[model samples]
Target: MSSSNHGLARKLGGWQLWGIAVGLVISGEYFGWSYGWAQAGTLGFLLSSIFVAIMYTAFIFSFTELTTAIPHAGGPFAYARRAFGPVGGFIAGFATLCEFVFAPPAIALAIGAYLNVQFPELSAKWIACGAYIVFMALNIVGVSVAAAFELVVTLLAIFELLLFMGVVSPGFSWDNFTHHGWAGSDSFSLSAVGGMFAAIPFAIWFFLAIEGAAMAAEEAKDPSRTIPRAYVAGILTLVALAMGVMIMAGGAGDWSKLANINDPLPQAMKLIVGSNSGWLHMLVWLGLLGLIASFHGIIMGYSRQIFALARAGYLPPMLAVIHPRFKTPHRAIIVGGMIGIAAIFSDDLIQIAGQPLTANIVTLSVFGAIVMYIVSMLALFQLRRSEPALARPFSAPAYPLLPGLALACAVICLIAMIWYNQLLALIFAGSLAVAYAYYLLTHRQRAAAASDVLLEGNDAARLKPAVARSK
Candidate 1:
């Protein structure tokens, strides 16, 4: 498709891109990562988080180079396509879809869980599904309007985290953080080590999907300059928020109580202040902003990805049609929203060895993310060798070293997650196999159709030459 036909408007700037990057991931600070504490105690989870943080820092730095160089709505998919063939592109794109699509349901469920605190009469599932409808509409309206709203909500969410830290700082104690450190053992035992590995996915939740901001590359002005700034600033912001919330919540009280809960931050607020306190109520209400920011931001990410894939002929072409009026990927957004709502309602609560279904979904999302990271990193190396002359306004510092570290860490995380959650891993692998099979079956017909069109044009040209010669 031509650039004009792509239908995405370039209205986003550096700060807006930053807002998207942070907004896409800020929910991690609010919930989900606490599940790491459940698997590994405070210290064990902390260790896992530290490792994951390094991986993200390296990955973001290298990923920025690809985003600026390619600057496509498909993000990693575009990069992988350029480096490998159509099959590589499909793998990257499908993984990205998994990461962005699965994340929203988890965030939506959290939104419902947060709202459930105020209204016990309503079901969390219903609230979550309703949130999908509302946000998907906002996204379909326009990118600028949606991004501006994302920035405002993301800022508010950031402030709330700082507020939580200040409120609980007085009650913070080292003993609480150290209590049951290393998975409740006096020292790091084999089980503690196993728990640390199991905690990898939850630690990943702390920084997952931040890369989704790169999906906005096609919509950003001066992407070469803006993308790098947004990526670096966004990762730094998440690292700080992730560490702060974890420590503050853990130190506030018995950290174990906070684990595996949907509303860990608000629950921590209750521990620091009375449940009836106005502060607790305020936190609960304001905490919804965090969920809203991530939910809305990720919805934006997934729709653009779907739009890009469809435009590139990987999926159904209908999804590529942009709203002529709104100038948005309305079809893609609605389709993705339907999938998210279905996931929420499916309520697939198959527990694998004591892990909750929510955590399993989280593991699935991380599995997708890990796949993208590994493939994208390899694509980086491949592109450097094959497309050495390609314009790279932003280059990854330290070359092979940084990208290599990122790839290594991603592989480690992938292995750890598979070993820890074999059932979830199997499900994810099966889904990928199905997606690839469909792609292979359909892509051949598309190729044949294109060949037929080319042959028809050649025939027309030959007839024109013969008619002229006879005249």
Candidate 2:
């Protein structure tokens, strides 16, 4: 249980895992996804959200099979590695790292925006960087404390979203929601079609990192029983919240006004409640819980991913070191925090394809999530055929059907994201290329041995140094 042995302590149960699962994604309801309104208008974005919802529903259900079977902290990386070997592991691990590491900056910015309502003089970016410091420190303190905090904040966030919806219900108008719902025309014309396609990443924001719960598998009290329950409940909760929040917000006032901003709900609510209303101020404060939940949870996610990758020798071994007193991946947590802080500052320096910086960061993170999803589905298929004897406590109900559907949706979304955000896509691709080159030049042999150790259901970092001794 001590980091002296370099292993994670098991301290989570089904409800805590459920909290992490929902907490990781609840911020999508609070903000970020509203950019879809700018891209596709209300109706078009709703359609896009439906498409993305189907994908996540199928994906989380299907993804559970691999998670329970391997139960590794690496999550998709472990699933892909077991099914496709080192090369597969590299792709999934890197993509996952990108997804987790990049997602926090967007949430951090949302946190800053929420705080700005209460204190206008503060620089949002500095508040964002400050948030990264606070939460990363919390994550490094220990997994148990972090998960408990996630559960509490997640509950508060869910309650706040429901409160927003209730307070705005009397102002909801079907005509207001339907008013110019479709982008660019009376019907789904060429421009509307393009907008819907472009909206894919924003819609994806609704359920982006729910799979990150798997990163805590090493710390789950009973992953086999808990992961499935958590994932299933989590997806259902997010879907209902996403649909309800989006519908109510669009009808609350001019949907156009809420579009193109990081803080959507408060703006939408302000239209109904007035900017100076105590209800409006209450919302601004409570909404921060959603952003904080996601920001903090994703920090936990990225650190574990970095820890897992480093453990497998895919990165510097020092990055994998666990804290002896805290038994947390302190080094990995700090490294990911440093990267997120840099990204938060970079928001003011650049614009990609004329979209807002938040939009681009969201797409960049989605690209990584989609890529990881594709590799993971392929891994699931390969594992089914090749590892028939491997213990599977929970089988994906429809087998090829469910996974195939998830794969198809992921591929389509990735294609649309690339077409719409070519500049950011190129940036993401370039970063991956650079990292892969480092992997090839410095870590191949050690990573190969580490791969074997993982496949044997052992902690790879512990055995990684035994490579020479084994030979």
The clash count of every prediction, one per candidate, is: 0, 0
TM per prediction: 0.94, 0.96
Error of 1 at 342 (Å): 0.7
Model 2 quality (TM-score): 0.96
Candidate models: Cα lDDT each: 0.88, 0.89
The TM-score leader among the candidates is: 2
Instruction: In candidate 1, list every pair of residues with a backbone clash.
Output: none
For every candidate in turn, the CA RMSD to the true structure comes to 5.0, 2.3
Instruction: Please write out the lDDT profile of model 1 over residues 20-95, one tens digit for every residue.
Output: 9999999999999999988899999999999999999999999999999888888998888778867888999999
Residue 230, model 1, lDDT:
96
After aligning candidate 1 to the native by TM-score, how far in Å is the CA of 153 from where it should be? Answer: 0.4
Single out the weakest 10-residue window by summed lDDT for candidate 1: 449-458
> Which candidate comes out best when scored by lDDT?
2
